[model samples]
Target: MVLYLQIIWLYLPIGLANIFASLSRHIFPNWDYPLDLGKNYRGQRVLGSHKTWRGLIVGILAAFLFFLAQKYFFNHYQSVRDFSLIDYNSVNILTGFLMGFGAIFGDALKSFFKRQKNIPPGQPWFPFDQLDFVVGGALLSWPLVPVSGVVILVAIVLGLLFHLLFKLIGYLCRVDKTMI
Candidate 1:
């Protein structure tokens, strides 16, 4: 029970980061990105251009805070019920930053691939784009959290479903102009 609770708590930063990043779109209205597929790298900004520095900073900060919380909580108990997973320092601030950065990097990488493929920004590309950030974030945080294969499978299935549902909600809310 404690382990599960701890795991859920670890995701708080990630959730908060997403919320902060979403706010960035409205906060930085001047950030206009042209969805040009034909355009080559040309040493120019692509993929991650839509990702604001402010968002990154906020997201990282949120992750760091969450990590601190987790660390404090763990240090208080020093044991996770019957599990010893808490024996490691996986819940540190550094781990939180890694997870946050990993997730954002994955999203940015997906955007880059989408542009290269001319899939259009915000268009839903099955598997790759949808799971990119989750996979990246998970990979980054995996070293810290010793989640089992079953946990990973659960995460993947639930994450994908949640992604679709959120996209649908965003569309219905008219926040997402694209139906993808």
Candidate 2:
């Protein structure tokens, strides 16, 4: 049980990367530089205007900050270290960067596919929208972390649940345009 909790805790930063990216639009309203820079493939936008540089930077930075906080807690609290998946002391910014990049990149990759399918931005893509970051983060962190397949599966499921819960909260609070 403790191990499961630890996995979910460790996965939080990765799972929340898309949320931070979405919130970045509000933080930097004027910086709407699309990552694809108006590029298109097969007569379709490679990645819609929503996948901006600002969101990517902010998401990665947020994840890095979150990792630092986790490291600080791990150093100061035995309980944190006891539940950690990695030695916080040994992990560096690269870990956070990979996790964040993987997540945001995953979302953008999904957006590419979503565009090909003619799905509009901000529209939910069902489980793909929820699981993309989980799979991306887990795959990217696989070489760096010592996580088991079970932990990865659990994290994916937890990510999906958390995404749905947060979407519902955002909708109820009138902060989001839609709820998945």
Candidate 3:
């Protein structure tokens, strides 16, 4: 039970980053973070429009802060005596940033496919759209802390389910028009 909780805790920052990215429009209306793909198959934006410099910055900052707090809290409590499993405080920050960037990158890749398919942004696109960010985030950070195969498999399944649940709630609350 405790190990499960610990694993969940490890994944929390990236999940929060995803939630923030989803809500970024409302959070920073002035940014005009291009959700629509620009006409030109230009240098940078070629990747995807939704994946903006602003979103990347915001995501990285959020992840960094979250990890910093988690590290600070863990240090203060000294609860996890077996500290070998966890990395140093600096490592947490680095890994958190990677997770954040990778998550946004994954979402952008999915958005690219969505545009290619002419699928509207908010429309549902099944497991690919749902799990992309989580997979990217986990993969980016996996080297830092190699988890069990069971954990990786569980993360993929759980991430998809969580995405569906969040989308349902968002639609019901009028936070989003649809789930994708």
Candidate 4:
């Protein structure tokens, strides 16, 4: 149980980034401008209309703040400090930024390939949508924290499960325009 939680805790920054990216788009419509700047690659949108600069920036900031909250909690509560998967006492700017920004970039990479395959934006792309952020977060955060294969596999599996569960909830509640 401890190991499972440690793995989940380690990956929460990326997961929150994914969720907050969607929330940022919904909350701040004015800021939702494309990172691609109406550009094209091979006569098609490079990353599609949905990949926005605001989402990336907001996602990164949200994850960093979440990390800061965790740091504060661990610092104040010495007993539960063992639950920390990474060094929460020290500033973890690089790890937070990598996990958060990497998640959006990961989604953009999938969108890139999805466009090449002629799949429209906001349409479901199965496991890729779920696993992309996890892969991106883990890969980019490797320099900051070299995790074991077991932890990586666990994080991927948990991410997939949570993604499916959240999408189901969103669909049932009629949350339209979501990238689930």
Which candidate comes out best when scored by TM-score? 2
Model 1 lDDT per residue over 112-138, tens place: 777667766556788775576666666
Tens-digit lDDT string for candidate 4 (1-180)? 888888888788899998888788778989968988989888889888888988898888887787777777878987658777666655456788888988888888998988888888988888898899888887787777766777888888988988988888888788855647
Residue 37 C-alpha lDDT in model 3: 41
Better of 1 and 4 by TM-score: 4
Q: Which residue runs of candidate 3 sit more than 4 Å off their true CA positions?
A: 33-49, 80-92
CA lDDT scores, all candidates in order: 0.63, 0.85, 0.71, 0.82
Candidate 3 at residue 107, lDDT?
Answer: 84
lDDT, residue 142, model 3: 82
Clashing pairs in 2: none
On residues 53-148, what C-alpha lDDT tens digit does candidate 3 reach at each position?
Answer: 567667767876777777777667666424324644535468878878778877877877776777665667887888988888888888875677
All candidates: TM-score: 0.72, 0.93, 0.82, 0.91
lDDT ranking from best candidate downward: 2, 4, 3, 1
TM-score for candidate 2, please give it. 0.93
Superposing every Cα of model 3 onto the true structure, what RMSD results?
A: 3.3
